[model samples]
Target: MMIGTLASAMASFARPGVCKAAAAYHGPPASNFNLGRILRYPNLIGCNRSPTKKSSAQLQLWRALTTLTKREGTVNGPAGTRFSTVADGVIAHNDHAASRIAASVARRQLTCTMGRVNYDVVVVGLGAFGSSVLYHLAKAGLKVLGVERYGPVGHSLGSSHGASRIIRMAYFEGLQYGPLLKRSMRLFLELQDELAAVQGPLSEPLFLRTGMLDVGSVFERALCSAQVQGLQHEVLTGAELNRRFPAYRVPEHWRALYQPDGGVLTPERIVQAHVGLAQRMGAQVLTGTTVAAWRVEGTGADAAVTFKLVPTDATAVAASKRMSYSDATATAVPRNVTAAAAVLTPGPWIGQLVPELRELCVPERQVVGWFEIEAAARSHFAPNRFPVFVLEETSGGAAYYGFPEHGQLPGFKIGLYRHLYEQIRNPGDLDRVNRTANAADEAALRSGVLSYFPTAAGRLLTSSTCFFTNTPDGHFLVERHPRYPQVILCSACSGHGFKMSSGIGQLISRMVREGPKDTAAAAATNTLQPPPPLPPSAPSPSAVDRHVVQGLPQMDSDSDGVDWSELLPFRFSPGDRPGHREALDRFS
Candidate 1:
């Protein structure tokens, strides 16, 4: 990296820089920027810390460019550096400055800074779900607007940054996820066609559906679940498992359940594509804008929860590094702001948004790193030959999952699930989870992987952590926002929800446009919804029953993140009479 680029970067921060205008905004930063710490994302400390050597080298290159520029004084032609390539200062990668420049330029190019008008719908949190919601809303011809705290396609934080995510047909998680997964497959195909036709940035067809294994010492539930759902699958014995994937050295008692129609999904790219489609369809997408609260007015005033907006500044970026946040310089309530339908998908921030979910949503810091492997073994990890795997009891203690080698993330990609840092009080507050691993933690995880793939362990190359928004029951939460019919919330994906994103987005649009006729939309969607408000002193729905919500694993005691208002705008009480007709008219 060059000093010149560094100087330029710092210099650029001057000029009355455009600071982030939101009290709560998010996005990725210079390469390994941990905005998760800023957003108090649940498990940020897990995946987004260290930078790859490649990023270091890039920084050095920038510095060198700056020096050359100074030495040359002024030049019309080659100053040895030009802002044309994808690696130029103008085209920032993980750098906050670059993301800012990119966002700034995009705003100008797309006329993004125009005055905001009203719309029918406003979407926030553009990860997997928000982006898709925007696309469908736009396609359905609704005046829609979207606000993403991160830069275009996401600021490079959260569980969505990775190259590939596994997609499967026979979900072991349960049949509840089967329909959505299947629909997502269809949407992905549709996306491929739509993107190819647009003839712009090309996103090719997704990886082939080779298959996947849910190899666990004590569980065959995934296999059974698939069978019960009538999905095609196979339970391979010791020899069969080894034969299908020789690299896997399964123990005698251990076996593998293979879902042949399963494969990989381009996770990060999926976010970009959906949002891109939405924007192209005329949905106003404001990157680097946070959803500061809003005012839900009207007879549908139930949509009263207002979302505030904010932009990024230099100090804002620096403070975010320390995992802190500043207030927004400016704020606006979108014209289409949904008083009701808010999808709270703050990946690791489950603790922040719905602290009650703390019990259900354990904020475990997890990591994923690439291991360099030989060519022969590459096939064993290839998208076609190598089935995406979630090996639970690999003679190696590591209960991890892996995808085919893609991009620079080396080796047959592997990551340990149990090796993750345990639950913390909060993901953002530094004092919470133990980002630093103790000897026991390392040994536990290391021993786990080492035990199973003895040779593979030796090849381990890189590692990074990610948070899981888990549901105690290991399902997902795609329900209406408590106390409000217009607001909907989506969260708790357990460990795997990236694959069904296309379908999830579709359902969001379907529900917004078609109302409750969107039954398949609900099944295809997963989340929790709170009942409408009752008279004061009324017990919470769970309180009236004297029993906790069932199927949930466990919950935290000090969960202040859940919206704890005395009365919901229009909560959904179990015994409450049907108010769907009125609600539909308002939303429609």
Candidate 2:
């Protein structure tokens, strides 16, 4: 009987202008209609269009009814007759039932419109490097998404959370970094100005120019790099350094190099700024979510990288509360997102994500501490008075770096490079180990402070632990993955990467925009040759011009013809150790 009534109503509504208004539907309320059972009939739900041609209005009504039926799941009503025909070209149902069906139709339409999950590029980490990539990609008008494991952009869980980091033009590692440093400094300043224009002025500046002082064995290298790069600097004995900055008490025998361009950068602030500005520029960011697995699908131009996103424990709990899911398992379901390309900058977690480079990238534990300054010595340790310094106790001995008291922090910041020499084979071990500063770590930092800045080592105010994603050669790995060219592997900065993150971001963005280079020939030959050098008369901008340029040019064109592939190659050979100079031939 119910089937007969529904059939009759469908036939009547199919006629032109038969049921134009609710008043026309004056038959008995079809409140007890069995949608679950009716769905089995092909003709009633307009699924079998081949049987007969149906009116546009009839098709619309039937489609809405089918959508409502599937979404609400067996909407139960009376089993007996409920729908009835009252007169010619008229049908009727309860007003409440009519409104419920309309609501369901609206919801189904909304769901259909809001289900797009495709992007041009997806950055798989929101650390210093990843955030910058996201911002640059978004600024270039690409649809980009940034995924972060931690809840906040600048959370302390990763390597980018230190309050302050050193930024200097005179790189002691190699002269190859000169071009990158110059470009990065320009970008950092431009970012500051851009943020000020959009979000008003920041309370704290992103880069602070306090200059940098390098002492001991590193002095000669720094001085040479500074001279070659045409940077303004001063060469002084330990006594001259003490005379210029009263806070230090260096041994008179040690030589020191001071470059006026070096300064301190607020790491947390830079990360946050990049993320916030990226979001404002239409970049999507997913925090408290992690990528469980990812792969490249298809080949050539049709290739796409898909990532499976799983919420962390904290994210799952928050989502459950907001959604009111009865079963916790429902909220834990993983979602997949597809992108044309992906940039992997997961920091220490890079090894876990890409097992191919596990041995190449290792995470080492590090500790940093802040020591209170004496009341009378506070003036000398101020940011304006004292410069950031790196001291080597003996030639090629353990080196220590420190920053003058600045920001809200209560003491002068100091840390030992590769502190404790504790290596973490498994990235997950970081979570299990104690993160608090230990007594032994504090004692080591205090000893360095006593040897150098004795006046600032009054008391231990606070301390924290962080990790360095180290490469075997103490350089960085900035290249596409060996197996998947669509996926770029950018990790293992060996502790001094944060400063060059801006330039790195620009490099990755250009790679994504131009599509992956065709290195198949090189792979086929199994011989990767270094890029050729620029002509002697090539017009290269000076360091000063690079720093103040209005429009930052591409790294290839503006970076003094430095080939990044030679500086940081992607090839990984186990047990094959290449000297730093071999990798960076420009410096040699």
Candidate 3:
């Protein structure tokens, strides 16, 4: 009920940014849970009401409240703690938590802070791009720091915590992703060596070079990957597909395009590896630390940009609070970088952090739920036994993918990536049940499973839900942070970015290292030329917002733009083609 009163107070503010301190005031229906806020002028925002050291969520809520309220007063919650404000003192300023929450909630502009001392090169995120870049840069002898508020690896918040991720060289997403995927698998092997966790989550091996299917509208042109790149693959008849894998009862109209190199990617373990490697290489990988704000400077090295971080030590390797990094460190150095890159791999947090990607980053409440099929039945879905599959036009008008059991998460977990949708605007608001597969969703999948492996679906047992970050064309966005030049961005996995993280990390790292320093003459004069052409398949993520929109960290450690598109399994019909019908009928 206090949330209602809190809303009214916030509504009174003129501009959300103007914040100030309000005298301690109490409201009706007081309780421990409700806290009063104090708003500062010009910046129409209020401070956290926590009487204790402000918790992160409280700080975020306070920032949201700031956008709406200016009158400082405490409203008691169920617990009955004094709904007092946090900016109760001159030294205690509005924290980074407030700024990030405001930025994410408003999705327009905000500020942030991280530590007492700012850093030279700060990796704002630790997912696929950030961690990889940190590791490579550190190894290259760069002083680097990698901070992640969610802790080592990921804390089950985004696209990084899933059990298994699919990996393949044949890309249908776009030509840009092909080289990236191929390089990813190789670096994954290298990363495995670095972590030395053989058999553990990070060390677990995945099925590779096993073909995958592209079952959507883009299958035709997507196949350019297979044709031009010569990646081993073929078009199979629905009957042949059924015979090849007795588990799938391919629908008459469904089509199957296979690329022999496709396989699975494990989420948690891989992140562990990337983080571990980055840390070992001397990059400080901090979990539970979040960037609160960023400043763009017109002059100086460290002054060009500044990021504030909040120490959520609970998740960090060591509990410490705050870290700061600035590019325009001195007023003499004019801003050299055009934009700073924010590798926004918040997984599910994509909905909140960047609302523009909201439509494309549809947050599907997918259950990583699995069946209790017999171990023998696992062969049907196993990476070696089965090429990771994508089913469209199935008997039930649905689509989904299946992965082999990696020892833990149980019998082949498979669900459509298009199940539930829960819109989130605040990162602090993420602690509830997201969308999950309902009985109908399970039933549809069960029917499809039964049609493929009649007995497998019947062996079902427990099931649960998780989430995925999606995009319209299922490709990734790797570009400069649109508004700020010093910021580069990498996000919108759309469900298939895990396997490529290794390669992606290297590319992002190279971009950071290159940081506008690459001269073409340096390459030609140095004779640092070429590798043989790699295998290819479909177009991987050609969703060119084409408007100079940002994309995955744009280069490999070698500074070469990793050609990622060649890795996609298939491309769509570009305008028209004769093989279209034949192609459509093959998987059907």
Candidate 4:
């Protein structure tokens, strides 16, 4: 009888245009499926066994199905329900094919959508990482919503707003990222193919394989990583480097590691692609909407997310005159959104949302300067002629990185890694205006040019400032909130996260769907593990006594076999400690 009532509710929802036509259709009528029907069928509701348990489970299931059907606009066949929808709707679910979902619901362990919870996951911050997470989640048939604090292009202050970010496989950081990096590369290639299918072959390239070069002792680690991960690379002495690319004067002592696989990533395009794919897959993306506050109500299976939202920019609509003043006023009205699970990928603004992590990850203002290249040397720095490079000083000062000429910029884009930073006290008020290239910035970059690429050193053309949300250990913080397991924290990429955004996004999506298991896999592969210090007798990477190569978090990868426990979130005592050090030791 309980199943019969469920079938009746399904039938009632299948009535075409009945609910849409009604000016105010509150819910299904009593004739459809009412509480009285369930009360009458005592035995069917398991009153013969644990009455309360069976009744509660059935009611919850019934309510969940009704809510889902209402959102999906169709009630599928009885037991083998097939949930399907077009762009910007709900996730498609085929219960028969995916038994895990049905079994979860039957076991009463499905906390994703309980009473009143609308979406399975609400992603805050629709930048590169957030957009990717939303796309993957929506593609997996989960009701997902993406909320961004800025416009569709994202705020210029964040790291994901640029036209280009470097992608490399020869990681100098450590070997742990090997597997994840390879996975990301594959996904990126797949994304390109997917885009080609939809937008035609002539569509602008998403990823350009221009190759990459590492000009520092850190290349030793890269060589090690390449060897361990079966990645292809070439070792070049300074003489060989100068012979291959005439753009720069390689010092006799400086050796370099070259990887043909490294290339440039179009960040803005990637974000847009993710957002586009996600929307097409029925994920709702809300741009220019700031998440004012979010809190979890209840706990575990009964938990729900309640968030207050406000417009990130109000004057834009009024200035554009797209709507009347009355409509503009309505746009500013605050909205309350509820979800089963919420992912906070706010990037630099993460600390503001979770105060406990404020100390762990701090946002720093970093600059990228574009310098003009002479017509004579332009051909030398073209995508085919020269590869992207990360050059370091012999005395262990700040490292500098730059890319070959991509179409977006009129000049060669270059910037110092982790240097030239100002602490961002407030994530909202990032100094976007006054961050133009000053004399010091120009002089510093020119000095490097004079020392290395002498011919291409031209005037500073343009510059932009972005934030680097850095952690102390430089590892990513992709774990659950200490207090709220329903709330996941997925940000603080330091200065080297954009390249890994694709893989990180996939891992994050998996976490939302599979819970602990996905999170463990991601954490195991992605969490930072710095290489052990080398002995003095070890041969220097540069083969010169004056030069030194320091390792840092640069690339991302994942391995096949993983010890799930090794990737568990840091344990913490139920106290007011910073990182829950006592409990975090469990993973350590």
Candidate 5:
């Protein structure tokens, strides 16, 4: 009885007008029909079981017969409209084939209707990492959606809005990052080129290759890692550094490791580029929308992540501009979005989205200050003349990093690693935190500038505050949830994650594509023993370094020469505190 009723309903919708429209519509070629994707629509099929290719193709034809029957005026009208031009083209081009398939679909009692849309993957948080993930996934031909709580892709509300972020290959944190950094640099360059080819040449390149200097305690570790990775670097005394750049006033005993590949990446531009390319590749992006909650439904292959979206004021305003208030209200109503998988890269908001990580991935407030350079020394602080540098104070306090004068922003940009040591217990508190430079913040930055480059220090020009989502161990957490494998978590990159955002984005895309099979394989080989103790006088290698050194080459043939095992140390285990005791860490 139910089958007969559904068949009658489908037949009623398949009117002569539908056939006429199907014949007249010019859409994608018949060969481009994706029956598998069409069959994956459980609501349309009225069942979740996978159908054979023959049955899937037949059901797909049925979907077109029913969906295209809607009034011609309703095409592309609302969410309820289900007209698929591609499906119509298939039916129009292969009338006999589609008729036979439609007969089979009727016999099988297959039913389809316009319903809530689903995506192959949904990336929450369109910040640096999430934007990159969205681009890679879309480029791979997956149906993807990127959701950002803020307005647009490069909003200043998040950590990715800064004008300049340091990108260096001579990693002082760990040797394992060398390959990732190299890959990220290559990806960034490729991204710039790709955007240039499409959007035309940019006013300024996405990345600027300003040589970098690493000083203080981590200098030796950086030098060692540089040598191990075969990176081009130079070790110079404080006097040699000052003489070479004429922007330093380090103690004679202090030594620095310099690498020419170190440079600056425009965070805002990079994020926008990734999002723009992703959109060009058919990735849907929702700005001013927040994923209030998410959960996995079903088990195994049938599992799907459903996110409840809540619109912010920005979304409401934009919606109001597009339609009537009633229509906008209806549109703004919270809806559930379903996806095969989800990648969460919400930066400081990671804790709010993934409660399990709330305590582990803590958000800390940080400030960056730009100081005007003296007229006489302005040329010395130019990107070509000065190099990005990280100076570790002799007193073992916070390290200060600075960039040469670049971008429209005036003055030389400099920031302390954990400026003011302000840790936000609640992510919401970030809104209340003062974003402008305070007197203390200015004084601290000025003090560092005076100590290092006295000649360049002039006056406080501008300041901005952003959050650094730090983990207890100060390493990135890039892994699937402990219990929910369908939900991937990529956050808590400590403070220096921007440089590697592109590479991490690619890695997460692979993780989503490989799914549970590769995840299980990684778990089987997760026999990661703790690193051997180092001498008291020697700095301990990071967990990443130990993993890379213990015969697990950072790059392998699998997944196009990216060894997933290299990330084992960063995995979220039950009680494992990664790099907790190893205090030897540095920020970009």
Candidate 6:
């Protein structure tokens, strides 16, 4: 009797024009329905039984769940009644009639419980990109929640915990990023002023305008991009760099590109500022908690994503135990949450949760160290006196970068972009101390230090180990998952993403608001809609174009860099590959 009634109801709702929108949905289907809509559908229950009867509602809901399962390519059960499909590909059969009734009751209870905790978007990972997304989404009036693994900002486990990261407009990565870089610089400056207003005058500013210089083969591409973008930059020979800076001994055969607009952005303060501002704008941020699992529950506006939380370590929980935040309207918030959409920017740990990208988003251990400079020469390492520099050595073929001494840090900070990277099998078991700068690590950096700024190699003041979530090609992975359209993948920074994270956050905000661009013309029509089908394993080349930019110009036709037409994300050159460089190339 229940199967017969459900068959009639499906036919009635399947009419050509009646469910055209529902038929257009290509993504996975949720085994859920709007209760009011189910009640209103004609003949949902035979005229023999009252429409409001509990038995009739249960049968109707059971039929709806079976229909959704079929649409989602799930296996059907005996008597055509099943609650939902499990992850292990097993068709949980319903045998007894009483068992079906119990399943319906449990599902109803779950729906009610899930409806209480709701948000438009939930961001996992509160590092550089995640925090920025939280701020932008909340500012746009979307109910947002941010989750981080560590308790306090000072824990410093991930990639965004360093004293400072360099930000420059003349990008050697690609000319296509030139516009976004320009926009990021503007936003970075604006963020500094915004943070000061709410948090009071910071003893140390967020961004310091220290000019930047790039020396090596990378300089040609960077200079060319600078010229094309009409940016302010000067091309100098090795002698000029050495003569002007005085702290460096440059090989006369090499060249350099100098841009004055470049500077350093403090990572710790940036994360804190973004979180504080986002919370004030009505976003809820939970730290020291892990998102164990999540599942999609419905479709479209009625769609809901529920996440399960796992208890963290004693240290992290204790640290965050007293750290509570009031909502924008001053209401206290609980620790758990649910949302319509979720953004996963978990950094190196993303692989553990997203099994598909495990091979692609490999976590590699990296070390960053600070070295004290002679007191008499400390003034030269200041932002105004010395510019941030990237050197590609022609001798040893290694590229190293450093930031001038700033604020409370007692020494200049430097590190090989990817020279000493050690692959980490699991991010959870990361060694924070990273072996305390062993002899090999110290010796490699010592050579570069003595060769470049001989006066600053006083002593190793401090060092810390961090993980770089590297993609196969060393480009960023910023798009919605192919299997789960509701889940956004924003990991694989590849060690160079923090500089443009502000811009990346803005781009992600639009993606969450407008959906994917190819299938849904949300940007052109100003309407938020679901995106179309994604390609297998990854998005098509045009996917980045549709969302990241309208049309990207090609990079050098025959250069060692990736083909711009392909728009491969998280792209780095063979020499630029983390910890791998040509033996002959010195200052890369």
User: Against the true structure, whose TM-score is highest?
Assistant: 5
TM-score of every prediction relative to native: 0.61, 0.70, 0.60, 0.73, 0.74, 0.67
lDDT of each: 0.50, 0.67, 0.48, 0.61, 0.67, 0.62
Candidate 3: which stretches are off by over 4 Å? 1-117, 197-203, 206-210, 215-222, 252-254, 297-304, 311-344, 350-362, 374-383, 394-397, 421-428, 435-441, 459-464, 471-473, 516-588
Rank the candidate models, highest TM-score first.
5, 4, 2, 6, 1, 3
TM-score of 3: 0.60
Query: Least lDDT summed over 10 consecutive residues: which range in candidate 2?
Result: 81-90
lDDT digits (tens) for residues 33-122 of candidate 2 = 223223333344332333255566456555554554445332232232111101111122333333433333232221111122266678
Better of 1 and 6 by TM-score: 6
lDDT tens digits, residue span 1-588, model 1: 333344444334322212222112243222312221211222222123322322343334334443544553212333322121111112222245444543433332211111221344667667777777778766654555677665545444455655677776655555455445555666776686787777555546544556778787524767655554454567788677877776667675677788766677766666767777666555676655554445455334222334666563333233222111122321343433432234455566555544444554565666665655656565665666567778766344547777766654666656666454465556454223343444555455455456554435554465544556665445555656444545556665667767767767766665564332334343345343322223334332321022222122222311111221211212332243243233334334
Candidate 3 yields a Cα-based lDDT of 0.48
- Which regions of candidate 4 deviate over 4 angstroms? 1-96, 107-115, 313-334, 431-433, 516-588
Between prediction 3 and prediction 5, which has the larger lDDT? 5
Candidate 5 collision pairs:
none
Whole-structure CA lDDT of model 4: 0.61
Q: Model 2 scores what on Cα lDDT? A: 0.67
lDDT-sorted candidate list, best first? 5, 2, 6, 4, 1, 3
Q: Which candidate is the best by lDDT?
A: 5
